[model samples]
Target: MPDIKKAGNIPTSMLAVASLLLSAPSFAEVYVAPFGGYSFGASEFNIKSSGVGNLASDEEGELKVSESAQYGVMLGFTTTDPGDIYLLYSHQSTELRTGNNFSPSPITDLDLDYLHLGGSLYFPKGDVKPYVTASVGLTSMRPSGEYANETRFSMGFGVGVAYQVAPSFSVFADARGYATFISSDSTLFCNGGDCLWSISSDIMWQGQVNLGLKLTF
Candidate 1:
């Protein structure tokens, strides 16, 4: 009876060890994810005019910002431990339209896009994960009419939360603020050969709110 009891305990211990080994490999496998969402925010265009443009001020401000739809893609790989680290890259783009209240004045359509490469540190508690991240990348702003393309080197930082709902699905929300260096150039006006103007403005900081779907693998 003593030998039978010892033999039964040996198989139980062995089964427990096997279970541990099977779950261990899951901690190191790479994870891939892609997401999309909408953005509702403001894109402030500071127009400083030279060469006969108009008269709003030495600095013209267009603050008539409206809600817009934006979409993007993201890829990330994370360590599988309960609390771990991850690196991700994502690209998001949107269109902004701004105009002055007065007529005969030129309307500006500003197309803005962002490219982000960042890393995140996550503290996961069961199905809920909270994370913080920092990213440095490019912001491209293009104005219709006579303004040249403006590209800025910007840095962003934010904190957000994600909740896993199923085996390979989650929902996330994030809000990030950008501090950027503004670089501007002007183009020749289409009306005439001599219709050329140079515009300059001070760089302004902006913020955005994003909510979307997250797919985890």
Candidate 2:
């Protein structure tokens, strides 16, 4: 397991915000939503020799993650107005294909998951509501086949629109951008005695667009 000491602070902040919202002096409306969407991103992996005297050379590769479907659930609380607080969990499965000089034959499958705490301000106009949201969370990255897994802190913001179809049900669409703060020298993929590569970015960015149904009670 990787040291998640740095990732601990984000959850604390999220909890504080949730507590504040829950303690507000108003009647709160609770809701649950299930959503599905597409996720797309790009990451760079750099490989270097780490042994005693074996042609030391550094090679870099770019992994372009293909657009893939993602799904999640959200639980929320709203006051009398259009402002609400929510907790969300989402999952995405994608493929990482090599770019530049790297071979593109074998694509590595990646599982990405996020747990976020967020708030949104909605502008209600008749039956349509347009909203903006910001969130802080943690993201887990797991690569299948031959790569190490890691968890990192992340933050994001989005804009969305919701349409009320009935008294209790509404349909919504959201587009968000998230950036995970991974350590620059963190190991991304490795093989025993053959190769080892670390991620070369201070942050990795991912974009998502989703459509979902929200039920309020």
lDDT winner: 2
Off by over 4 Å in 2: 1-26, 43-57, 190-195
Question: Candidate 1, residues 26-134: lDDT per residue as tens digits?
Answer: 5443444444445455545444333455534343435323445555545544554443323333344444333553233435555667665656677888888888777
lDDT, candidates in the order shown: 0.54, 0.77
lDDT of 2 by residue, 123-210 (tens): 9999999999999989987788665676889998999999999988999999999988877765655555443445566877889999
* TM-score of predicted structure 2: 0.79
Specify the poorest-scoring 10-residue window by lDDT in model 1. 187-196
What's the residue-level lDDT of 59 in candidate 1?
Answer: 38
Clashing pairs in 1: none
Clashing pairs in 2: none
**TM-score for every candidate vs. truth?**
0.61, 0.79
Best by TM-score: 2
